[model samples]
Target: MTEEDSLRETRMPSLRIMAKNTRDVMKEPILQSILEKSILTKTQLETLLIDLVIEDEFENHISYKEKASLRSKAASRSRGVSRGAFNRTLNQARKNITRCFYTMLLLAYLGLFEFTFFSPFEELATRIEGYRRIRDTLAGKTDLSSEEIESYQSAERTILSALDSLSTSLSLKSRLSRRKTGSEIESER
Candidate 1:
């Protein structure tokens, strides 16, 4: 086998493990709802994740063509697109991420981010981070009592419900309803 083929063969197991873990995370109801409501599509998120894995996980840096192939395999896509398409999706994901940051900056600049209104968003972020840590902790434990398992499950369910509710509340429709209209502001002035 060629050197590149041998390298790919060695990487397959790690790639598959990553893909399975990513799939499991994406299957969470809260994550599914958030993805559905977010600017990035699954393909775009998958593309970005694959790109990061390829870049950060390997000893040797890979080319765009190889990255594209790896992305297709990781996603289990039957009909994989070309490198160009993968690059396009990666760019789109990056653009969406940048736009989100800019939007937050604009909100801060306008002095529109009141603690009363934005605290929930911050809390949601903290909860999501904590949930990830909890999952990681649970996954690392090879042996656990039934009670412990049950406790983890209960916590997961409670967090999922809270996450879903927080996501729903942060939706555009909900935000718009809570905001004052231009006319309302003018009338107040």
Candidate 2:
């Protein structure tokens, strides 16, 4: 085979693997629930993940054009988008991420983090990391014993339960919709 043909053959499998992994991650239950509640839109999340994958998978820096092309390919886009479109989405994703951090900072400054209400968020973060570790360990193995499969399933259920609990805690009540006038606030003080 010609050098060009050989290169194409090797590149195809890695590209396919990247596409498959992207799809699988999007389908994950925890991620699906989080995305539904997240500030970033689904398209923005996909764009952000693709950008991160490009940074992590490439040892050397690549041009924006190349990054955009790879991002499209990894996302399994039928036709690659122009670099401008991809860059726009990436920028939106970054803005949402920055805003989220700023909001967190505001909450901390208000001393809200000291309350028990925010403790679940910290727990959820730790649980999510543990879930990822369990998933990665299982994903690396070609074959798994029944015990390993059961252990992974248990971990999945535990994380899902924790997520559900957190969701319930954050849900707004009907009474919370009532508007209080400035006089009412002063009266409470």
Candidate 3:
């Protein structure tokens, strides 16, 4: 093959398997099979595993029944899916559920706080036709009436306050692991 063709064919290795200065005794064939089948990406697979702990602890809540059903459906569909692909889909579904759960909590908090759904800016935008009316009205002018100026300011305040309250909702870091659980873990069957 030409050098260009060879270069084009090169692929990056998955980061999870990379190790430095040492090697483990086990190859983890089951995980390898999952990867080969496209059950999930390494990152997403890790998330699902981590979140599974949290999700399991939450089984007493409302969604355990629904998710169990969904998992059954996913199991049926995943029969044809490779490990990586199945992992990707499962991770996305998990992220969606996680997001929805947290979002509902945030919304409930906002409701308790009696926060306005539409801030002054949004109200103004509606009244002004989505900023167009204000833009056209003030295109040639530098000053604004009190009501006219409050719209944008109100929106900014609402968004800032909402974000400030939701700041706790965002978490980006995660702990990594080789084995998903303790050695006692076994097949469901």
Best by TM-score: 1
Model 3: weakest 10-residue lDDT segment is 14-23
Clash counts per candidate, in order, are 0, 0, 18
* lDDT per residue (tens digit) for residues 1-189 in model 3: 997445323411211122110012112332343244343444345335423543444333313222222221232432123445545566685776688678768867777324343243244335435444444566567887888678755644544454444333121112122133322254432
lDDT by residue (65-153, candidate 2, tens digit) is 54455554445656356799889988999999999999989988998787766666788898888888988998999999999889888
- Stretches of candidate 2 above 4 Å error? 1-16, 72-79, 169-189
The TM-score-based order of candidates, best leading, equals 1, 2, 3
Best prediction by lDDT: 1
| lDDT, candidate 1, 27-118, per-residue tens | 77767867987899988887887778646765567667766665544455553468999999999999999999999899899977764656
For all candidates in order, the CA lDDT equals 0.73, 0.72, 0.41
Position 13, candidate 2: lDDT: 56
Quality of model 2 by C-alpha lDDT: 0.72
Ranking by lDDT: 1, 2, 3
Name the runs in model 1 displaced over 4 angstroms: 72-79, 167-189
Task: Give the root-mean-square deviation of each candidate in angstroms.
Answer: 5.6, 6.6, 22.9
Between the candidate structures 1 and 3, which one is better when assessed by lDDT? 1
